[model samples]
Target chain A: MLIATALASVFIRDLFAVIMVFGIYSLLSAGFFLNLNAPDVALTEAAIGAGIAPILMLGTLALTRKKWDPEPHAKKSTHTPLLPLIVVAITGAALVYATFDMPYYGDAEAPSHTHVAPRYIQESGQEIDIPNMVTSVLASYRGFDTLGEVFVIFTAGIGVLALLGFLSDGSGRKYWQFADTASLRRHTVLHVIAKILIPLILLYAFYVQFHGDYSPGGGFQAGVIFATAFILYTMISGLQAVYKIIKPELIYWTMAFGVMLYGVTGLVAMFMGGDYLDYNALDHHDPIHGQHMGILLVELGVGICVAAVMMSVFFNFAGRGIRLPEDTKEGGQ
Target chain B: MSVVLGLFNYWIVIALMMTGFYLVIATSNLIKKIIGLNIFQTSVFILYISIAKVKGGAAPILEEGTELYANPLPHVLILTAIVVGIATTALGLALIVRIKEAYGSIEEDDIREKGGTT
Candidate 1:
């Protein structure tokens, strides 16, 4: 099913259909993760891949659908598929051949299972005092890598900002106006439903954020869900209401501040006479308490940065105007 | 038959990866290319998760008397990777939007044929 949807999405030219198929592919893959006992990964995939990806793609589609409908020029299909097919065939064959040496699916003696994992499973409760070993590994043992991940998100947000100018900039405001509508005047049901559901989703995001030490969600998933709540509200209500509530400048500040917060937590730990990102140093009484404090703070930082970045990217993409082929003189509206 | 039974899932993963690779290279549409990239990334994610599975293991939540558990390292790694993937996709789509604005058309042939900015 996943492969079918992926192939269908690739083969289909209608951007909307492609986006929906892509969502289906994500959903199916998320289910596969559940089957594989990786619920945290599955939740993140479902939220970002299925929920947010389609929205962003739809926003892009709205901008470009005009040019797509008329197919631009009838003679613009002079591309060859033979080369790609040959290259992909060789790569696929090599990958398949290589997998023969991999430990059979679900083998207990698999190298991945034998090394590092058992220690994480056995010691995490004693060391980090967290039920979720993935969380302990993510926020404690591999904290530096996670920090880099947060910054990568920040950089991507900045790249999007540089490409699609922020709402504060006068240049992209016109595009926002084009995408914006006054309200959900026709469907009061949608408005009411959104009003009720948005708050619950935001609340759930917070629960996921704080409870990640025990469950399948963490800062990344929580942050995406938090951003999704706002994105949903923006979708149901107009952009105007959301902008008025959060303000564009606040997003930039929160994004930078989130990264700063993560860095500062590490510095605080260092100043406390421990290595960088050493959560044990965060608390003098109990190293486990320090780990708890460190993980909580860092996860909050990640959540803040992720939420801000997702919202910023969505706003920028949605705010940008679609460039029409007829308007050859000037760029997008 | 033994090999197929043992490594069938990995083969499926390769098929998905190759399909994505084909779309990314063969397609001229920028959106399709991004979708292809996503499919490819997802296949890789599946590969990693598949590697972490234990024959009769529970999810890696430390609880009482749980003898077998899936590998947590891959989950940790892939968690970050999934976020990175979406970040890349978002950035790619944003670039495509800019490309559409600047080049007037998103199709590669059209962009080249018109002899506009590459």
Candidate 2:
């Protein structure tokens, strides 16, 4: 069933259908994770991967065409398949061989179990006072990688905003018209639901942010939950409300602030006599306490930046007016 | 029963991931490609979650007289990944919408043609 859904997603002609299929794929993947014993990851996957990504994809599809024209010469020629076929064959063979050499599924004796991972797993609870090993790994031992990931998200948000010309003076004009009475009435149900859910989601985000030490929650989940609330607001109330709530200038500033917060936290540690991002040196106190404080502040930075960047991207994309072909609009049911 | 379920599930997850990736690379429609990307990502979630499972283990919460529990680490990791995936997808969709408005079609070929000719 999953294979069929994936195939249909790729092969489907209609863009909307494809997007929906992608959503299904995400949801299924989340289910797969839940079955795998990773409820936190499953929650993240379901929310971000399935829920938000598909919605964004669908919006993009609505703005674009339903069908693609084949390349002019390729349609007339028959020479493309042979090379692709051979490549697929060779790749398949390589994959099969690699599978054979891989450690048996869930083998406790695997090399991964014998190395730094087990040590970290064994010691993390005592060192960081966190039962969740993933949080400990992400925020401390490999905290730098998390930093890079946060920056990458920030960059992507900035890139999308630039692409939509959000910096231009005239870009915000069209989207600012207050929601019409009729449209508001029509969307009241959605609006009410969003109004109820957005606050809860934000509260949950904070819970995830602070509860990382004990449970399967952290900065990324919190950031995403925060972004989800705003996205919902934009969807139900239109881009104008989102703009009013978080003006473009504020969005840019907040994004920068988030990144700056992260950098400053690290710099403070450095100034206190530790290496760059050495959170343990933040104070002349116990190293673990310093580590805890540093991780908290840094995760807050990540959550803020991620949430801001995501909202900015959503606004930019939705703000770009759809320019459908005249015929499609006229011929609509 | 437990061992068989674990092995079979992993294999299926791996298969889905590969197939999804293959489609993403091969498809022409931008939306289809994104769908493929989602499929590809979900597979990784499966792999991570599977690693966290422990034989005869329950949920990772502290419980009376229960020492064995599934690892919560992977679950935590997957949760974050899920959120990121959603953000990426939402952004991707928004881009597609704008692209449609600007170029009149979501098909990769059509967009390329317009871009090239212009």
lDDT of 2 by residue, A140-215 (tens): 7776767777776777777677666442335554333423212353677787887889889889889988986677
lDDT of 2 by residue, B42-94 (tens): 77777666666665655554444765556655655565555556556655665
For candidate 1 chain A, the 10 contiguous residues with the lowest summed lDDT are A322-331
- Docking quality level of the chain pair in candidate 1: medium
Please identify model 2 stretches exceeding 4 Å from their true place: A66-90, A167-185, A322-333, B1-10, B48-104, B111-118
Interface RMSDs of the predictions, in order, are 1.1, 3.6
What is candidate 1's local distance difference test score?
0.86
Query: In terms of TM-score, which candidate is strongest?
Result: 1
Provide the TM-score for each candidate, comma-separated.
0.94, 0.82
